[model samples]
Target: MKKPLSNAIKKIILDNIEFSTSHGFPNIVRSESFILKLMWILCLLLSSGYCAYCLTKSFQDYFSYETDTLLRFKRVSQIEFPTITICNKFATDLSRSNEVTELAKSGYIKLKSEFTDLTKFNEFFKRVDYYFKYNSIEYKDRFNFVGFDIDKMLLNCNFNFKECNSSNFKLFFSSTYGLCYQFNADKTNIRKISSPGKKAGLSLELFIGYPSKDYDLYKSYGAHLFIHNSSTIPSSEFEGISLSTGHETDVILSKTYFQKLPKPFSDCAQDSNSSEYIHSDLYRETIKLFGQYDQKSCINLCYHKYIFDECGCYYPDLNINKNLTRICDSDIGFECYSNHSASYRESKICIECIEKCPEECESIKYSLQISHANYPTPFYADFLMTYDALINNGSRNFISYSNVKESTLAVNIYFDDICYSIVEEKPSETIEQLVADIGGFLGLCIGVSILSVVEIFDSILRVILLFFSKRMN
Candidate 1:
């Protein structure tokens, strides 16, 4: 029985162990080759994991650089748009045309740059009709002008216009708060009030930059004043006014030509720039714009949608500083002019001036022309007394850089028909090479993966052949 038990244990041990004898020399070599292949596979896995970590790090760095460059481009693009949007918002308030507003959003019509001839204006306005609807924004403009860049300023604009067609085009002037004039649907006969001076609401153009397309801030082409010099130019022509150097005159009151008295103040003197008596031709003209006694018959009939400066057509108790650059006081007579803003504190046009003629003579340069060339940024009242000459058609030509004897920063940018400015530089080298290297390295990864699979297949085939040979022996 003990012998049998020992035999059973030996059989159990034999079952657990693989007892085999090779018949030929080829079998031993083949067995050894299979063991070597298994060891190689273990090494291949370890090497592959290590290489994958290194490749991941390299790709991560390349991706980071590409992302940084794209972010910078987006920043610059944002800066280019705010200026245009701001101007569009303001113009939409005055014009009431959705067609014009849409063109503004698309960034086609830059501020200050004339939208070419009227033909262009009509075509562009027609396109403006397609996108944005005619809706009035509840709020007024809020510009952060003092110490901010274009990028920082756009954060404030919240106004959107209720764009209407030329048929519904309404001009809500301050001259008569209750009445708005409906100009012809087609923008023909632009400034055709019945009279000027005693009964006119001031009409003008404020040269603001395309809030978005203002590429050069150093040059003062951002917000200029385009006053319509009624005294210098005629009501018949606005495009014919020659461009003027905005040094002395900082603004261009577009309604100057139709101001009453049609008096030209080429060599008159006045008090400080703050006095109410220093009424611009446009101011004096306001009397004629709406002061007529026809109030009984045509109280609110003809003027359906007009924007008059004297009409009190404001946003109701809004503390918004008016576009009227010339502030007034109650001191009476041709007093001095002040540069500070009116706190609603200054006096309105004197009742006498509102009802009767001036004790002295009336100003010839109606509407107003704030030429930045002559007046600089903050224009003074005394300066308006000594006027040289005014332009009638288009913009008055200024002394271009070509006309100047010496070169200057101003000249470098403002030359002939257009302003030529130098562009800022950017990093273009390191970026290009890094991008190329990433592409090459990714391609190398595919090649390495293919080679690794081929080696694994070859090793597995060798192991199978060895196993067959041993079984046959």
Candidate 2:
């Protein structure tokens, strides 16, 4: 009732004002009032137009907020996604240095670290489900596993990659006589599945090369692995990657991938100005498997016998003679391990297991590249190749996965979200990281405009009142 009365009063005032301008006091000719009224109307119109323009611009900006693609993770109750396996548990220490061990123990999982300087290493991965340890030599032949290129292994999808293949487990190399091996070092024992508590299991770690935060789902899942040890590692040099290990269990990092630590911690986490690749060796594995690192010294053929120094071999406990290059000559396919050095390297805690396998030597220099294109994604993943073993569903685990590619790769990711999407990167000299910046900015403007307070009508009313009062001579 009050609203109608108010409106009626306002209408009457408007009509009276209009009539006064056109004819009231015409004899006296109140031209000043007429001119002032006209001016007020024009000012109101201009204000309304300007306000509308500003509002539209602002709205376009709100929805267009720039989201920096950052790495993250999520968890669910069900197992899904294809092409994965979990072999071991890992500790997420998050530091980089000589402090490979000395991480906080979380349940059955122990932190593993390097016996020497840490570089390019990690102790857990998302590929295969990893227990807290590596498979024992006693149960080496328990599983039947195989690796293949994307072409043969990719069951579905339609991405066109340059090359894809199925792994040949029986033969180690492409050629039969090469490297004196029946199967590639990795696939030697890969097909059998075992219950978690029943047998020794696979060990995995993650080493990422690029930023993974560009994807939304990955950012939701926190690392399942984390460790904090205080004994073997001095607090100053805690060498934990995304995951770490302790003395009791293996801390493993994978060479298949890499990641950038978020902000403040990233700078403090670096051993030096440079960033090193992460690997899957727990502390103990580092001393032994670290021999496989593709260093300039290890690349050539070994003609001589086992000369630790000649081959550029170095371990924390062993003082190898650098003069004995003949000991590492690649031509003879020979390498030697001093029984004494091996003893010193093995700790008393694992003395029994260490002694059982005295001789540790292998002669091979090879690199692996994993690629596939079934569910056609962009060409961005072409160079991305790092594998992991991680928990798939609540009840299952996968031992080998080639990084978080199509988490939507025919496998159900459990969430009703975009399996994948990219955010714009801030401008840089390299255009690779500069996609869709303009689009993102526009979206932000749109969203902000919807909630804007300075509206066209409000501005127009103010402008009209200002001019009318000024002209009331």
Q: Ten residues in a row with the worst lDDT in model 2? A: 174-183
Error of 1 at 248 (Å): 5.9
| Candidate 1 structure quality by residue, lDDT tens digits, 1-473 | 55664565455333322221211222333345777656655654555565576567666665443221221111111110000101112222222235444544444334224345765664444323211111112112211111122221121111112222223233222110111122221223333322222112222222221223332212222221112212121111112122223322222222111112112322122221222554544333333443321211121211111112333232111112233222222121112211111312243433323333322222322233332343232232212212211421212112332321111101000101111122222233244665565444433432233344454455456556645655576
State TM-scores per candidate. Answer: 0.20, 0.19
How far out, in Å, is residue 349 in model 1? 44
Model 2: residues with Cα > 4 Å off, grouped in runs:
1-39, 55-72, 78-201, 204-473
Best by TM-score: 1
lDDT of 1: 0.27
Local accuracy by lDDT, each model:
0.27, 0.25
Q: Where is the poorest 10-residue window by lDDT in model 1?
A: 407-416
